[model samples]
Target: MLTEEGKKRRDALDAEITERIAAFKVEQRKMLEELAEIGIHVEMVNRLPNLPTSDYVQALPILIKHLRREYSEGTLASLARSLAAKDASEYWDELVAMYLASAHRISTGPGNLAMALAAAVAAACPKNRLDDLTNLVKNQRLPHRVLLLTPFKKRRGRDPAVARLIEELRHDPALAKEIGRWKILPSQASLRSH
Candidate 1:
């Protein structure tokens, strides 16, 4: 435990991770600004694939920290949607963390956050991670429960992982009863509004 070489190696890795996180934040801000200029929308979400990947596996937790503390509701939702569209498997855990950390924000309401969480879960999470999605669906927020269920309600062939999630929920009597109470929650204001 007291080896100089090991300590040096650890220090170097930490420094590299810090540098990568900084770079990712810069690129994320630049992309957000670009989206800001164009107006955040489905079209903006569609443009995310054009941006270079940030190698999120290297810096996901840092990115999630930045997202949780600083990003606006619309921007968070847009980024989540973009991540969904990209469907980068490496991004799922941090996406879930971001959703859990910020889901209580009253600014966006649970609807948008739930939608974003659903999109991220549906697009990025693999079959093995279905348990995480199930846990997220059990979030205390009613909108989280309802909105997370939305993606699963789609055709089974569209996303089999999500379909599996639907089946899992169906077998859980508690979730089955909860899913039945789904209601129409109000949508958020336009994404263009800061």
Candidate 2:
């Protein structure tokens, strides 16, 4: 029950989506390859947690602790990005806690794993949990003296939770100095182009 134009448009969109998925898988494979080169192996969970169980909640702290000891900061950051892509909402609180407890091991600069973790927190944590998330980052020295003030532009634009979190940081007196250190480049430009 579709018009000819509508059917054509739908087909085009499907093709585009398929291409995007293929590109993403390539990038993920590269990340996994790099992790392998460093001897950091991930035994992917058979099922990613969708509901927050007490056991799942408890496993996070232990996992983060073990990851920090076993991998370099760069490897840990890459792992965070890969996990965030899995849409693991149930683990946002644990991710924030992990960052707070071991942020010293995370390195800085754009595309930092901490930023990806923050994005997961932004996408998953409810509004009421925003303050807790913000406080954790603040207490952790805002993790490398810079934070992504806005979510990276995507097909859907910025996630609302991350936007709210960014707003919260904007008003914090303690973070005023650290926040000032971040420089955002226009999305169209790459570092090499600048």
Candidate 3:
């Protein structure tokens, strides 16, 4: 069960993993320090590493300021979610700008920055902003358009404007294929539930 070569390899692998973990911790500490300089305290950042545990009221302006700054995908997603949790409705335009600017870099996944931004917009966007949301869905390229349409899923049932937008998209030949493939958006039945 313990050939010398196998033991050596396992030990080497363990050492590499340990080194990587230590390096990652160092990077996190540096990032935290840099963020602290910009007014994002470590406690708020810690609460936002995953789901937001509390509202970062004092840190909201700083967080919004850095929302569009270059950062790792995970960090961006966390920031978006934290903003959404705080109901940053007043910064809706800024959030939409960030979402649109980052559309090209968005990856297809559940916990990605794009998804978080979509959720943030959904949480913060007002009735008057429906036109902007509709325009985004209509203008964005495939996949991104579909992803952008997702936020409406939560609203389609309750908001007549969102329902109309979904109806319009359903009839668009260009988007039919991509939208049909994923089927992640709200269905007609759900839309009728309200």
What's the candidate order when arranged by decreasing TM-score? Answer: 3, 1, 2
Query: Where is model 2 poorest over a 10-residue stretch in terms of lDDT?
Result: 148-157
lDDT (Cα, tens digit) per residue for candidate 3, span 131-160: 787787787452345555656766766676
- Give the alpha carbon lDDT tens digit for every residue of 20-104 in model 2: 5454444445444444454444333212233333324434433444344434444455445434422445566676666566555
- Give candidate 3's root-mean-square deviation (CA, Å): 6.3
State which candidate, 2 or 3, has the greater TM-score: 3
Q: What is candidate 3's local distance difference test score?
A: 0.64
Q: What lDDT score belongs to each candidate, Candidate 1 first?
A: 0.53, 0.47, 0.64
Off by over 4 Å in 2: 1-69, 106-116, 137-140, 144-194
Deviation of model 3 at 90, angstroms: 1.7
Q: Write the per-residue lDDT of candidate 1 for residues 64-159, one digit (tens) a residue.
A: 444455455555665566566333567777777666665665654212655675566566766576567667776556344554554455433455
Provide the TM-score for each candidate, comma-separated.
0.45, 0.38, 0.58
Clashing residue pairs in candidate 3 are none
Q: Which candidate is the best by lDDT?
A: 3
- By lDDT rank, best first, the candidates go 3, 1, 2
